[model samples]
Target: MSWMTLSLTLIFVFIPLLLSKTLNLGLERDTIVAALRSTVQLIAVGFVLKFVFDSEHAVFIMLMVLLMIVAAVQNARHKGKAIKGITWKLFVTFVVIEVLTQTVLLGLHIVPATAQYIISLSGMVIGNSMVLAILFINRFTAEVETHRDESELILSLGGTPKQSINRQLMKSIQASMIPTIESQKTIGLVQLPGMMSGQIIAGADPVQAVQFQLLVVFLLLSTAAMTSVLLGFLSYRSLFTERMQLMKIDVE
Candidate 1:
């Protein structure tokens, strides 16, 4: 698409802004800021990705992946800041997700170990993991708050921290994973995924695009499961005291 065509896409943005104004939803400023930031950030990322792809240096590729993990951690940490050491927890979760996924993909020769494929897949894995982390933490915090008395009663009855929080933790993990699972159930029938649709628009064979999209779908399923389970396990421990008592968590 030309610059002019891209500029014309602002019509889509304006539609939301107009609705927000008419309905007095008070989202105009946020809508405008998000649109501007997305445009600027994506353009900057496009240039950086081009340079990294052209260089094909392992150092540059690793650096790009590191940046993604750092950014993902930063964005996800806020949702769980009430839990101690949430920043590092998110960092570790994203790194593990990246390492585990790449190991399987590259070890089996499922995809080329090139900057293009590695970075693209890393972006998807890290992004999805970050969202899952946020969802899990949000729900987990709410659960803890709601069940504080029950948890304390369990602790008073000599139950371990893990036993006390097991129900809430499992519920949070399952809740966070539901969206990813449900979306996959209706993927092709309800809508075409962006990656597959983009490839088809770029004149790639439909069969090839579908195959690639399926790979991504499978990768995302693993990403969602690992992210929720790992982050939940890592975070739940922080909600307790060394004395096996439930610590008070103030959730915002």
Candidate 2:
């Protein structure tokens, strides 16, 4: 698309802004800010990705992946600050998700190990994992707070820390994973995913685009499951005292 075409896309943005202004819903500022930020960020990332894709050096590729992990962890850690060592917990979770998914994809030769494929897939995997982590942490902390008395009572009755928090932990994991699972159930029928639609728009064969999108769908399924389970297990222990008592979480 030309610059003029891209500029015209602002009409889509203006629609929301007009609605917000007409109804006095107070979303005008946020809509404008979001549009500006997305425009700037996508343009900047496009340049960086072009450079990285052209280089295709292992070092540059690793750096890009590392940058993604760091950003994901930083964005996700705030929701779980109540959990001890949340920073490292999120870091480890993101890193593990990246490594594991790349290992499977590269190891099985499912995708090329070039910067283009690696960075693209890593972006989706890490991004999905970050969202899942945030969801799990948010739900987990709320669960712990809501069941604090019950957990303490379990501890008082000689239950282990793991036993006391097991229900909350499981509930959080399941809750966080439901969105991903449900979305996949209605993926093609409900809506064409962005990646698939973009490829088809770019004139790729419909079948090929669908195949690639399916690969992404499967990758995200695993990403959702692992993220919630790994982060949940890592975080739940921090919610307990050394003496097996339930610790209070100061959720913000």
RMSD in order of candidates: 1.3, 1.1
Off by over 4 Å in 2: none
Predicted structure 2: lDDT: 0.92
lDDT of 2 by residue, 112-155 (tens): 88899999999999999999999999999999899888888888
Q: For candidate 2, what is the total of clashing residue pairs?
A: 0
Q: TM-score of every model?
A: 0.96, 0.97
Q: Please report, in order, the local distance difference test score of every candidate based on alpha carbons.
A: 0.94, 0.92
* Clashing residue pairs found in predicted model 2: none
